[model samples]
Target: MTTKRILLYAALAAGAFISVFPYLLVVLTAFKTKAQLNSTEPWLPGVPPTLDNLGRLLGGDFPQYILNTVIMTVLLTLGQLVFTTFAAYAFARLRFRGRDVLFWLYMATMMVPSAVTMIPLFLIMRELDLVNTWYGLLAPYILGTPYGIFLMRQFFKGLPAGLEEAARIDGAGPLTVLVRILLPLCRPALGTLTIITVISSWNSFLWPLIITSGDATKVVTVAIAALKVGIGVDYNLMMAGGLIALAPMVAVFVFFQKYIVRSVVLTGLK
Candidate 1:
């Protein structure tokens, strides 16, 4: 058992190092000079690190991209929380005709790849005159996603019924009970959903690229992509921008890592 535990620890450590290697390389490259970045010498770590690349990134349109990403992340997270929680609650506890059938249909949509829906969704947005607007980016997410609803529904199912019963005994309306009792108890699930939505929305590339043209609605990922030129790419500047884009995600993970882990555990418990 001791030997097996040691082996497991070794394997886990190796996996973690492998995962972090690329990020470490990016951080190193972010601080390298343009010559160092493109030189035949290894890009792993520059002999003398410099912040000139980082300064260039800070001086550009990177700040606007960060703002756009934050706005999109916050909007998408809040929208998903509200809509998914309500839909999940209804699906979990409410008894209406065709509820199961409707939920099944919703779940089926999950099997459909986003690539398949991209062109049609874009056309619809264009027709509605939502192109090149924040609304264009946020509108699709406002309707609640199937995976979010599924997660919330599972969490709601695990909740005890007596809380709602007690709330009713106190003359609390259904909405009041949901808001005051159910939502509070579902914090872990909500945290998980928030993390997932924020990260996904923040890192989104293809769809946002397809819908929003130019700086009108350019997100951080798109902005980073645009930094590359036709023939020669500025590796240092691009890495600096990439590092800046990664800071928020790292901050979120550092602050909410505990809650995120608990949420994942609760998910498996269900």
Candidate 2:
């Protein structure tokens, strides 16, 4: 092979190692005992791999945290998908006064940092007495996101107009066209949205920590944060919890990776 091609391959290999090394450390650390974790060989694999950390985590409130995270992720993803799909379809296909202006104005919100809205959202939740409730944890997110709407809108715009026109000629209304025709055709985009939404909701820490309290409402991310004791961080248990929290997202990405790539490629085409 040419020297230039060899250099390119070496660069790619270095980048891949950099990306995966932390995760490899976490996984290795998860199996190690607390003693091994604290010892000089902390960077190495467990001397004798143990499931004590996993056992302890599952035996405690961690399972409940996992369940809560799953429930919140599923509910929020469904709500966002529904809301974003309708909004995107309207923005892409319908002609209303100031539609372009309104859509652009809404999309501009994405430029604003989420931190800027956190206070106002928290105050709104407090006013509604939803503080520490599941509703509060979900309310700000279920309404759809500017990015999700933008993605769906782009995909919708890329679709052939004639499909909707044909559906309309067949006595289908706008809602019917959306539900029966457009939605089925938008599977790749929907899959991409579902994966993104699920992962975001699952990994959300700050909002959940702020809105939720106690074991009853705490999600996996908050539960994992609670692992930090006053004395010192328990790296083994923390890594175990991290792996547990990461498993679902990994599974999701593995399953829907193709669709995600397809959506990106198609969105670029649009």
lDDT of 1: 0.88
The stretch of ten residues in a row with the least summed lDDT in candidate 2 is 261-270
Measure candidate 2: CA RMSD: 1.6
Relative to the true structure, how large is the alpha-carbon lDDT of every model?
0.88, 0.89
lDDT of 1 by residue, 1-270 (tens): 699999999999999999998888889888888777777354368868898888877787778878888888888888999999999999998889999999999999999999999999999999999888888888988779999999999989889999988999999987998899999898889988888898899999988998898675789999999999799898888888899999888998999999889877866776
RMSD of each: 1.7, 1.6
C-alpha positional error of residue 7 in candidate 1 after TM-score superposition, expressed in Å: 3.2
Please write out the lDDT profile of model 2 over residues 1-270, one tens digit for every residue: 999999999999999999888888888888999887777475588778899999999998899999898899989999999999999998999999999999999999999998888889899999999999988999998989998999999989988999999999999999999999999999888887887788788889889988899777899999988999799888889999998988877787688788778766755665
The residue pairs that clash in candidate 1, if any, are none
* Model 2, runs deviating above 4 Å: 267-270
Q: List the residue pairs that clash in candidate 2.
A: none
* Model 2's TM-score against the true structure: 0.94
